[model samples]
Target chain A: MVQINAPMVGKVLSVDVKPGDQVKKNDVVLTLEAMKMQIKVYAPADGKVVEVNANAGDVVNTDTVLVTLE
Target chain B: MDQLWEIFGGIGIVHLTPGHVVMWLIAFILFYLAIKKGVEPLLLLPIGFGVFAANFPLTGLTEEGGLFYIFYHYGIETELIPPLIFLGLGAMTDFGPVIANPKTLLLGAAAQLGVYAAFFGALLMGYNVAQAACIGIIGGADGPTSIFLSANLAPEMLGAVSVAAYSYMALVPIIIPPIAKLLTTKQERAMVMTQMRMVSKTEKIIFPVLASVIIILLVPKSAPLIAMFMLGNLFMESGAVERLTNVSRNELMNIVTILLGLGVGSTMTAETFLTWKTIGVFVMGVVAFAFATASGVLIAKLMNLFTKNKVNPLIGAAGVSAVPMAARVVHNMGAEANPQNYLLMHAMGPNVAGVIGTAVAAGAFISAIL
Candidate 1:
């Protein structure tokens, strides 16, 4: 299991993946909005998403677990 | 009957002039822009109200010992509020991008070409040097710096210059895109910049101090704004002064913004604001913004010629110091050209640097003129 953590402080703009969905390394898993700019968060490795911890409009801090992948 | 006539004569409407009515129209336009259009409402709303109140004849609101007069006199004329605004700005700003990529500082500096362009333009239009200097700073796209410089150099032109600076800043999205497009090819706009290196906490904490020392040393006249700015940044980056940081960026910022806006707005009396020069300020302001945007883009292209890592020339337009707005514009432009390109973070380096660049420019003007 691997946990995908937020790269920085921002509000989650969207979560692109769900549990049981497959993602390739570097695939955008979510979008975060900070400083009025939207940043795409990429998957670190190939994985099947197991749990999503944040929702659109949720403010997240750096290192907050955003998704758990198996 | 004579007493009744005297009472009627003392009424505000009896004192109204055509110029006062014109000022009211201008104030209403500001109101429409602030409330209906939601453009820069925080400052414009109070400024609009200030304009409205000041225009009412016999109110004494902008006279000696009046509320707005006090705000303008102690807050702006004394050179207090703009620096305080910079304090809050510094606290809110994150200099990580600038620390990670110092080269963007040049992009910030290059944008100043617009300042000189406007300065020369203003001089050609027959404004005295001080007034031209104040007008030139409108190109910096920094409201506080423009206010600071105008208050110091040309208090008479403060209303025109501040209005121009903030109006143009809110119009960054509209102003930057065409200029950026005109200069860069589709391929240059589409270039993807790599992620900036992570900046350590030590680097962040040290940056404000080093920058303050260096910048103030270089431009001693800038010490007021730069010192407070770096101090506010220190509060944020030190990790031990979170409380101070919070207040500086939030409550203090809000309080000062109201005072600053109202003070600036109150200065827009019909006698002061309704002038051929006010129109000239608006014209030169747009010219300054366009030149600043073009110069930033051109400098980025110039830097590309020598650098190994190709920078998306779109990020250059972010060097006008409109904070996240300019950066967001660059990011959106980059995304439109190439979906994979995320220039937001890369643009931030120049965005923040532009703030410093503008302060230094204002300081240089002050040093040379005053």
Candidate 2:
């Protein structure tokens, strides 16, 4: 399993996928808000999402695991 | 007949001096640069004409009751036009890039080294402390800030300093690339930054207010420039104020630009602009700009040493307050180094920060000297 990390510290504005969903590289998995800007976090590779860690409205920090892809 | 000769002697044709002819030639060169070479035509065209009009002996265009006299007195001397120009600039600016990557603000601060370099150079050239401060601000590569500083500290050198600042700003494309290239390597130039995180609307709405409140509290002297700039930004970000935003960026900006140019140009009488000291200001102005660009790049490189993520050093060159022009140069240079590399969005972080940095530097100079 490959763990996808949050890029910056921010509140999760939205989550785009769930466990078992497939994502291609660069496809946005979630949106985060920090410093008054929304940041789109993208999938790092073509994979099936095996686990989802964070949900919408959750506060996250840099490198916090957001998803596990297999 | 002797009485007739004396009476006619007061006519403009009889009063024409060598200085008037020399100033006319200089004005023609400004016209050629603006119209043909296409260097900052919006301001340069009106300024060139103002110079010509002011030089035509006894036209009173620059005197108390003259046409341009109003522009000089109300627009420049009273410090009305520059802050208005800042309003337009703010409405046109997008702070998304700077807000997304806040660390780039340091690159903006780094570029102020140019202002200090020129300040000392001007002092060494025998300009007084006030005059040197005005001359040093030319390195900021921002017209309004340079004008604001000169109006307060060295009104006599306003014409020379304004011309130097605008001319160097227009030459940002030519001046920055060589220095940027010399300081960076191919691999460094090819370094692509990560994709920027998107900024939210709520964040956008908050930025202008927060910036004004914080920056003003830090430097009250910058209130005029910063306050107007934030007001314009607020007009744009509010979404409810489209009409005001459109007018500030368009009609108001155009009119103020014309008056500002004319007012600045009219100050260039032969008595003020033709002196040896004017030449020294020009020399120091270029020195300041070059140093500012170099310092930005060097600071970026220095930052790279400590940070895990490598930044393309060219963006640092955009720290000189020429806005997108300097940023575009960095983008083009990055493309030259690597075809797929696009640094425009990233370079903007430092580009806009340079504007704030220049304003802050101007405030420091104002508080210290004035």
- Location of the lowest summed lDDT over 10 successive residues in candidate 2 chain A: A33-42
Q: What TM-score does each of the candidates earn?
A: 0.91, 0.84
Docking class of 1: acceptable
Candidate 2 per-residue lDDT, tens place, A1-70, comes to 7787776557999999999899887677887775455566768688999998999999986458998999
Quote model 1's TM-score.
0.91
TM-score of chain B of 2: 0.98
- What lDDT tens digits, residue by residue, belong to model 2 across residues B78-151? 99998999999999888888888887889988999889998998889889999999888888899999999899
Q: What tens-digit string does per-residue lDDT give for candidate 1 at B70-178?
A: 9999999999999999999999889998898898989989998999999999999999999999888888999999999999999999999998999999999999999
C-alpha positional error of residue A59 in candidate 1 after TM-score superposition, expressed in Å: 7.3
Interface RMSD of each: 4.0, 7.9
lDDT of each: 0.91, 0.88
Best by lDDT: 1
Range of the 10 consecutive residues with the lowest summed lDDT in candidate 2 chain B? B335-344
DockQ (0 to 1) for model 2: 0.04
